[model samples]
Target: MTRPIRFGHQARPTPDDDLDGVARRAEAAGFDVFLIADHVGHGPAPMVALAAAASVTTTIRLGTYVLNADMRNPVQLAWEATTLDQLSNGRFELGLGAGHTPQEWAATGIEFTSARARKAALAERIEIIGRLLDGDSVSVDGAYHRLVDASVPRSHQSRLPILVGGNGAALLGHAGSHADIIGLQGLGRTLADGHEHSVRWTTDHLDAQLGQVRAGAGERIADIEVNVLVQVVDITADAERSLAQVAEMIDDGTTTTDLARIPYVLIGTVDEIAEKVLHCRDHWGITYFAVRALDDFAPVIDRVRQLE
Candidate 1:
């Protein structure tokens, strides 16, 4: 099957930067989506920043790349997301995740919970948030969240697209069952000091993770949009050298060959990268890609647009 491809640019806006101009540039650069990351004390708030982007741009879709479920009440988050969808005139896609960063929890004075706890909490929120976004009155007596006779303003879209991002089996399984978009983030393993583990960068590991999502999705797999966040995009004449550098950065005993196979890193000339993206869509059913907002990625966006 030939799946349709969509490109999203993930923008990190500092307080000193021109937010409106950034959104306008993304729309001009042939991007289909503009996404913001949710982090405390690192960048602007995701939904608030997207609201600013929504006011300036007319066509590019605006969204949080993935909001941490541990941070907010589900009912309140549903209201805020629906409101943003209304403000953006149905151009909003909601992305939610089980919280992973320990530093963010420390910074916010929120208790850092185990991965299992976070995933379970996220599952509950997805249920409540999904219903609320659909304009359903909900009353849930759950361990993590409680909602009594709650309903949010209906989203402009009959059902706003929900993107659930994660790497673990349980979390991806939940995403497979509920989300419109399933973001295949590689295994998100972080050290105690907030350093990323290189194991998450391996190709074999990602394939295994996707298998779990497939199993959980079952018959609904054909209806779901699969997405990957491209961590490295190097368009250069010396593709092998770029791959080597990425392999070293990942440092998980991964070879250049293995790096080449991983869909999340695009390292090649425009033609080569474009061909690889199409190959990935054909083989793995991944057509939605999110890359960091950088000048280097412009040609790649143009190339992917041509494929459509």
Candidate 2:
């Protein structure tokens, strides 16, 4: 069965531009969703920025690409999510993640925990957030978070969609069982003290992660929407040359053929990219694709919509 394709554009707002204009453009450009990155230094507060975007756009879905769980208490997050959903009139999707990027924690004076601990914390938080969003008063004395008779304003939607983003097995397993949308990211390996790396671009690595998700999901597997973040979409006539350039940039001694197999890097003309998208949908059941906002990606979005 072929799932309908949904394309999301990730916007990193700068201080100089009009955010409302950006949201309007995304809606006009045939993009299904407008997403914002959550970080302390680089981007604006995702919830605030998305709320502003929500005010200007009517149809486009507004969401955080993935909100780090460590940053906010689940009860507070529930309140903010409910407000955003109400403000957007049910066009908000909550994307949460086990906080990566240690620097963000350091800069904010938040304690940096081990990856395992963070993932465990995220699992508990997801449970708490889901209950609160569903209008159930929750009381939890979890390892990381404690909620005492916490309940939030009900969301506009009957059940606000929860999207969990991760590449590791434990997090993906949790997402499989809980999330409405499962965001497949690169392998959660730390590259540096403050930075992380994802092997998600590789087909084999992705297959392994998908296995974890499937095993964890069990009967609920059929209900989840599998999403991929298209980190690089290079639309060019010379696909080989573009692939080579990208491989060199990655500098992992990866060949062009190897890069061609990676789902995250889509290099080719619009038609070729569309073919690859269809192939992925048919083979992997990945229908949701997100790419960084770029002029080159608009045509690909248009093409994918036609495929849908």
Candidate 3:
């Protein structure tokens, strides 16, 4: 357990199994956390689904992969996060984001604005949520939302981890300003550089991003956590075959591999995935990784348990 790799599964909107079953199996399979992919127009509510996960798994931390800040109410989110943290024995990590996805906004009839505006709104919302979590009466006025002495002064946990999800230069500021952990997105498998015999710089950019997150983090930066979610498992038998399978998935729209042009979807055997991830820990200085398990990734999950 020297590496302390934590595993989590994507709670698909239309999962094959019941929520309880999915949560139980994930915990039984040695996953340390369970997270849902959050989207408003097309997907289920991440927190609501996580409630079921919390009911079933006692030890595993429960939270969202990344909840869109634009679509969520800070008041409700503050309550939900604290209540779940208590229910799960104080193991909840909140992942918030600046909203994107025009298709989703169109579906919901919500006006989508420039990225800069969204970032500002997200920053304000995080500050509000943090204050409420810390037992303070919050009053604020912003371009998006306003609160006057808004209070949710009760909380079950003293502290809950809030994560900002995105890699845009605009977001690094908020990650530094408010987030306890910053999530780097990993998907769309069109990584043309790493599979070949080139010295990978994916590790290099990750190091730089995490460094920025650390430097930008002012007071809370002291013990900030860095997590990257990578789709690191594929169905094929060998390394060559798995990489090819991942290449095809990139073509088929099942995986995304753009962490500075490195395949975040590390496609290979358990040993291969471990070796690939070690680069993140050793080279990039990123220690916490949340893996998105695919259908063919059962073997990798089994292999991760062996490491444990």
Ranking by lDDT: 1, 2, 3
Per-residue CA lDDT of model 1 for 61-148, tens digit only, reads 9988899989998888999999999999999999998877788898888999998999999999998899999889999989887778
- Provide the global lDDT of candidate 1 against the true structure: 0.86
> Candidate 2 lDDT, tens digit per residue, 113-222?
89888888999999999989999999888787766888999999999999999867788898899889999765557677666583545677778888999988999998
Local distance difference test, each candidate: 0.86, 0.86, 0.68
Better of 1 and 3 by TM-score: 1
lDDT of 3 by residue, 24-98 (tens): 877776667788877664456777788777777788788787887887789888888887777777878788887
* After superposition, candidate 2 runs with Cα above 4 Å error: 196-200
